[model samples]
Target: MYRTWMRFLTPGPAHHRLGLVCLGVGLQHGALPTVGPRTLDHHVAVVISAGTGWYATPDGRRTPVTAPALLWLTPGVPHHYAPDPETGWDEAFVDFTGPATAPYTELGYIEPDRPVVPLTEAAAPRGVVARIARAARRDNPLLEVETAAAVHELLVTLRRARADLAPDGDPVLKALAHDACTPMTVADHAAKHGMTPAELRTAVRRGAGCSPKDYLLGIRLGRAKELLATTELPVAAVARRVGYDDPAYFSRLFTRRTGMPPVRFRAQQARAVPGGYGDRVPDPDDPPMIAGPRRP
Candidate 1:
């Protein structure tokens, strides 16, 4: 029987906290020998660079995975897994321990159960691999910090993908997501997607398990909050982008949805980012961006 490996990441003095793994293909060519049953002090992620691997969990559950698969391993989760030794896996991942970790968890990216989760098919994780390569090139303090920040990003990417893939999705849900930042009407979306409004509502209920309006509102609210907090755009502009017309009405809707006015929302978002981490992430308070100006 092939022996399972549990390769744990060793953080240098320059490294602290993580959510990403940025290593080169050099140390990643060989089969990971220390993956199965190894202790995870922080969190170790496996980002496949150029090989096939099998990710298995405790209790004998296993699945074959390949490059492009993002493996999220939380700290303290004792699990046995490894790569397909023949081809061997090339990847880098970290336990991602930091203040932002909890917020990531709250966003439903990392789960308490299984560690690995796949990201959206539309986006490429090549940047993560590049970041890892950059880190592997050196062990300097700056590199260490960069690796940690990169891991956090990898987590965020997966979180965004999770939002995209709704478990119990339906036609209306899909339609609403089709253009979250644009001025879209549910009736138009329903017609475009080939269903009557009522039928769309029913499908949404059965497939996504949420009301169409609620689902759309949730997505819009998330976008609105992001824009209000991250961008220098005026509140009126942010509201306009998110489907509201009048700024006063927008403020009311924003308050109702987020329980705080747009201005306050922006302040809270600023306070939430980790010190020195602001430059890394897009302004969380920035508005939802679209290709066009507000609808007529």
Candidate 2:
């Protein structure tokens, strides 16, 4: 029986981020006619769970596709692939791209030269694609964000799986670093990745030389500093912007971490630059005023 489901996302500014945006997701079953032998403008990842197929590249290179494998169709690359007539494959796919995509390529997660990647286990990839498909069906207000996040997770999963075969560094570290801005507790963050708090802490410490809580706090505080330096927002507003609820607590934490309050830091920054904080030049003759050592 032939069956196919696809969801194409509308473009939106909010979906744009350092990480990839999921442009579309789909699932297909049964043999299909040859698609492409043409080029595309965006990337597509096809995970084949069953049956067999063949994919052809722009340079006239044809690759045999078997079950339990992934086929990557890179942007602007001429390609064509189709399922076997006798044994049509079950395929799940997601299309995505962003500023972060190139880094993945450089990191060897995605390769243009090699189109087919065999999967030791197909269930996880299939589940993620199913999640994207299901979420796309809901058409939620946060669909873009949700799908984008799923795409990121999918890529991380692929990379980690590949890494396991070759024995690279821990993937949890990368996941933690990517999710640092979200206002979740370390335990919650750990749980999201199926790790206990203790396990997460140990992994993070081994990978980043700090506890997960400290890592998240550092990200929040850095954002808080940027807001204080760049905007005229109230202290409370800045605190909220960086995930703090109580202004007083944020102030105390800021003071504890930096050895000066947010207000004082802003004032010092403003004074350091002539005219205003936006001005690039500091007073040439003015001695640099250093804040006290940061708390451990």
Candidate 3:
């Protein structure tokens, strides 16, 4: 019968306005029966990590509760829930509120009508609850800030987990998008993820409608463009920064892809801004070359 509960008397004005605040956090194991066929003024998220039970609504509808599931209690909602007495469950919960809550509801992350959301895995949600509980235990100066941040993190974690479970979601695309800036060949990237080059290419094409090499090249060029437009870094330096050791080869590739040399592209962009490039001199020897039409 291990149980711990911590409540905040006042979360303060700062927490109230941040649009999200944690009012309390608790963990219960082998606890006694039902908590209310009544209503609450704030929201509470109960994560059931083990055991079985039932959650009932005001209209006599009873929903079965299982382990590794999220039971949401929305504000002012009439609800009653309890674990099986014979085999009591383990549960962790956090009460939270703020103006930011409405957006989450509208985004389908939280639903008032749907009280139970079965999680494929409970580790992340359990970890977040533990974090909130730990932060609440410490009577630190940044208690409100820390708790609010943790709550936001919890919401983000839930949303991401849901996204990962979505039928159309492709994690391979996400990995590529995040790691595109790294200097690695397509084969190397595939090998790192325990995927063959052909498999990686197929996944990338299906997810992003582009080959792996093309996707990586696009990322490199995009970064190069930003650097060229904003900084005074030399072409050779920009080339190295974008994983290209050969300045001449990089310049040719940039020209082929963008239809303009790096220097010309920079000058064109600089001239677009008012009072920009007024005293700057363009490199004179960098001639623009127009390729002939390709034969089919």
The top-ranked prediction according to lDDT is 3
Whole-model lDDT, model 2: 0.79
For candidate 3, the TM-score is 0.58
Better of 1 and 3 by TM-score: 3
Ranking by lDDT: 3, 2, 1
| Model 3, residue pairs in steric clash | none
Q: RMSD for each model, in Å, please?
A: 10.4, 16.0, 14.6
* lDDT (CA) per prediction: 0.61, 0.79, 0.80
Q: Estimate each model's TM-score.
A: 0.52, 0.56, 0.58
Query: What's the C-alpha lDDT at position 258 in model 1?
Result: 72
lDDT for 274 in candidate 2 is 32
Candidate 2, which segments miss by more than 4 Å at Cα? 163-296
lDDT of the structure predicted as candidate 3: 0.80
lDDT at 78, model 1: 62
- The window of 10 residues in a row where model 1 has the poorest summed lDDT is 271-280
* Model 3 C-alpha lDDT per residue in residues 214-252, reported as the tens digit of each score: 888898898888778877879999899888889999999
